[model samples]
Target: MKQISFKNKFGYMMGDVANGLTFGMSAGFLLAFYTDALGITAAAAGTLFLIARLWDAINDPMMGVLTDKMFRKRALKHKNQKVDKFKIYLLKGSWPVIVAAILMFFAPDGLNGTQKLIWAYATYIVWGMTYTFVNIPYGSLAAVMTQDPVERSSLAVARGIGGLIGNILPRLIVPLVLVQFTDELSKGYLIAMILFGVIGLVSYIISYYTVEENIVHQVSDVESTDKDGFVKSIGVLVKNRPFVAVSIASIAMLLGMMVNSAMAVYYFKDNLNALQLMSITGLTGLLPMLILAPIMSKVVKKFGVKRTVATSSLISSIIYGALFLLPSNAILYISVSFMAAIFMTIPHMLVWGMVSDCIDYNQYLCGKRQEGVIYGCYSFVRKMGQAFAGFFAGVGLSLIGYVPNAIQTSQVLWGIKFLTIGLPAFGMFIAFIAYQFIWNLTPEKQKEVVKSINM
Candidate 1:
């Protein structure tokens, strides 16, 4: 077995750090930015998210094909040296990603509503495409890093830590900063996003330089034309029962997660009448992840990824459901939210490891490994869920007539409560159902798949 050093794992983790910085910012605040700061209606902001993501439905898979082709060409040219196909994209793609992230937030206040919407659409689509350029390749890199299941879990843990920092910091700090500058929320967002963009660029550069791709399996090595290879790759992924099952479950889970994150600001401000409590909520959520990081490998080894995810999903559903009945005090709300966060972190930490497992399973079933394509397809579905979540949250808010920075009416308050709590609880139940009924990859089966691939 090929050994992945600590340095390699740390570098791989940093890629996700960069990813989380951009992704976390968008997932947590983009809609709020549009509605509150940019003077767009909630429905319009949601439309922007949906339209950009619709384009990703095409752009993601094509990037996967392009990534695989690049890997094959690099291997042919530099036969003597190990060429890192994914990292090359990370290095080159980071520039546009950084620029686009800043542009997405830096819309000119001088533009009319229509002009601003156009700017939002153009910059956001560019952000999504460039993001795919970096993210799909980065997500695909783990399958080629090392084949050890336990090691993959450990890598996921490291990535989880990076993800937590990248995700939580912006959520916690940015909102707090914005509250201080309520008179100039837009300016505050611009400064914060630019700062995050710079940090993301630096992190990507470090990750590109630090991580080495040690394991290589060329998907394009088969004796077939490019078109034939691409079609076959898609067929393999489509026919993969485990991949399909996991994808369904992932979409549900991500939809809930994104909706919760996006609605949190509104929930805290409008319902709880405490905007600063978001920092506390973010901190409490971070605690469980910190406690679990050191021992997640052991947990996965004992419970298995699917079981862990299923169990966690069910627990989260229960907690969210319980929140509806609990006293509406900040203390109780924070406590229940903390408990739900604990359960939610398990799946978040294990998801990438499970993706690596699916890649291996695909290779086991088919004689070729199309990591880029497989990861791309998976990402495509995940992005779809994210788009719908944003749309739902935006539309849901609009339906209840949520007014930005105003004292919300009772009906709007109830709607915000339902969005923050009820919708995610339902999403969690759907995820649990998908995993219970659809996923069939057991621990023993995963071992067999890995062993067969190694042989």
Candidate 2:
């Protein structure tokens, strides 16, 4: 076994931070932009978002297959030095993520309503599909980079720290940074999106150069997966009990996150009577992950990943439920908001690392390296959950008599309140249940799986 240097780990963490910044912006504010800034009705915007992302459920596995083939073909052509091929693929893959980030924010020249939705469909599909191309390979790079569990855990923490930076950038800074650009909301968001794309591109470039793959320690199983065989891989991966459980848990966790993301935007705008509170709430939501990340590994080690995630999620659910049950005061809101933030973030940081472990488990089970496909499966489900959240939020808003171009009624305000706080609270509760019962992988078991694979 070889060890990864601190320098390499730091570089990868910075890359993760940049990725977090870009993707975080989408989760943080994409729905707000669609409904309010871009002049699409909330329901229509929600449908479009769902449809566009559903396209990714189809596209992600293909990207995974393509990634596997790229590795296979490179192994053949390079023969002796196959590691360079994987590195080259990863370096080149970064650009698609950068481009997609820019395109998702683009509102074409002279488009309204139906036209805008069509434009959104086209660009958003490309963005989601291309992002998969980048992220699948990027996710797989970790297992290839180092075999040391301690090193991998450190990398996960650094990635969390980076994500905190990324989440903060668009949430906290964009509103302030884009103020000087234009009064038109769409234009401001467009500018912010472009700026984020550029920043992502620069940071991804640094990551490509600074982080090195631990090619020498890599286990070779040069079997190529068929791009047309997603259905088969789905069956195979689902049969792996741990992967199935983790996927379900991820869907529940992400549903909570995405739903709250949309609802929080609405809450701050309407009930709170503080439209700009998004920036403050967003900053507060982000800090816990940053502050707690350094110790997250130790915490998980002590408590174990499943228990830590389950507990945090349960706490978050209670806090979300209490947000409505408690008095609606400034101090109460602030306190619950911070607690909700911590709960939302801690589980997220740990779960992805856990998901990565599941990929390794699948490899051990099948005697094939299918990290890309497995990660794609996880991403596919999570994105589908996000789509569902968007749909639910839209439907909930419409049912609540959310009217466009008019003053909202007390009933509508009440609807908005439930959609934001109540819905996510339920999701968190469901997630807690899933984690407690479904996820059965303990740390010692995971170590055994890894050991069995290497042997």
lDDT of 1 at 269: 83
Candidate 1 contains a number of clashing pairs equal to 0
Per-residue CA lDDT of model 1 for 222-254, tens digit only, reads 223244567778788877877887788788888
Residue-level lDDT tens digits of model 2 in 345-365: 776776657666777777777
Q: Give lDDT per model, in order.
A: 0.83, 0.71
Best by TM-score: 1
| TM-score of each prediction | 0.96, 0.91
Q: RMSD (Cα, Å) of candidate 1?
A: 1.6
Off by over 4 Å in 2: 84-90, 177-183, 215-220, 224-231, 329-331, 404-406
